[model samples]
Target: MSNDRFSMCLASDLFRVKKLKSVFVALILMFLILFLTFAVCWVGSNLVSKVEVSETPSIEGETAPTITQEEKDGLLAALDSVINDSLMGSGAICLMEFLVMIITCIFVGKDFSNGTMRILVSRGANRVHLFISKWLTMAILVVAYSLFALLVSGILYAFKNDGSFTGYDFGILMRCFSLQLLCNLASMTISLMIAFLCRSSGSALGVSIGLYIILSVALSIISTVVSLSGGNQDWMMFMPMQQMNVAASAGSYSTDQLCAVIIMPIVYIAIAFAVGVSTFVKRDIK
Candidate 1:
């Protein structure tokens, strides 16, 4: 494609998404859900956490009230844990995925619903370019949402801890969040494929949500059974959501585990886009 056409396709896709009221609604709704999850975690921590009192006696018979080095390390570790949970936990990632599903489903499925895609193709708009533009647009939105979530989590952490960021590894947080973003992209692609196949926003949304529920339950049962049988659940690592959820706490991840985390989602994205785009190019738009 020429550079001018390429730019136009991208610009058109972005503007379309930007004009969708549901996109902003989905973003706000997803963020609220994510924030509530963290808020619950914070409240539960307060309920269960114990206050550590130093044992050293002062001249006036008061406890020193100073935290020991070990306690400080523990606090820092706890902070890191919260950050990870916020970024890459199953709840957070799933919420992000659902948001992607809604946004992409509407964005792509609407074109079919309104006969816009058919009109575009009739006017010589390349089907391949349209696919690429929509894919890239969804990717941009997913990554932006992930980054915003990370920022909000960081802000809440600082507010809760008096603005202290000590010993919190921003590097590791980014890496794990990057993994979640990859999963988000793959999930978006899956939803997009369904949108293309179904070609109706409502059908695509319903199918995607139903599949999500079924897969979540099935994976949980399988993982539990494997663990109780003393069998390794390493196979679960190849699944995008599982990989995204555990990545944040995988302190001793093997190189192969890391590779799966990165590679599996890319594989999903490639396969999904291949199917979605090919069908889109050949299938009759209704």
Candidate 2:
């Protein structure tokens, strides 16, 4: 069959199967994430309020302590922290990535469990076409879920922060949001690869979550080690999660650094998709 025809047919089949159900599930998960974000912000704010900063450190060249009252105030307000670049910027994206990974893993793995792949192959659908259509559909769903996350998070932030956009840098905010979406797309593609390889929702869920958490911790350790050694590893910027967090921060990262953030995720996504396609083409459906 022609690629277009195959895609349309598969899309129709997908729609008839679990498309709406998957979307509904994603919506429910997004709301849950929204609530979690609120709770985290509230708890963090309360924790920050209990902290007292009484230390006055002396500088090498200064006779008196350099501490200022504003600096001694310790932490920003709860609302400020929630609406700040750190949480709202990449937090929504992080939550979206988590939801997309779980949703896509289960959605694709179910085909293997229910013998859907065998049925599709028996119907004479090209393996490559089937793979592309399903993968593309899941990618689209990831984008949808990520956007929903961005919207809901933005609304909550504005509501809690008294609907203030004043002094906010629109250019930076938009850039961060765009980076979040791209990073989530990269993460989703990786999850797709994991789901395809595992071929079972239970295995896929465990592997995907564990790998994500472990790799994040490993990278952080590597970063800390490098920092302690006083070695500047510019290549660390290529890490997708790092790039996402850096972009989410209000710090002054170079333009080249920001550009790298955009390029690295695409490279990761391409590699992941290629691997998934290869595995799907070669592996037999049991």
Q: Which candidate is the best by lDDT?
A: 1
In order, candidate lDDTs are 0.76, 0.71
Residue-level lDDT of model 2, residues 20-39, one tens digit each, is 47567767866775667676
The estimated TM-scores of all candidates read: 0.82, 0.79
Alpha carbon lDDT at 213, candidate 2: 82
- Superposed model 2: Cα runs more than 4 Å off: 9-26, 39-73, 77-79, 85-87, 166-169, 244-247
Per-residue error at 119 for model 1, in Å?
1.5
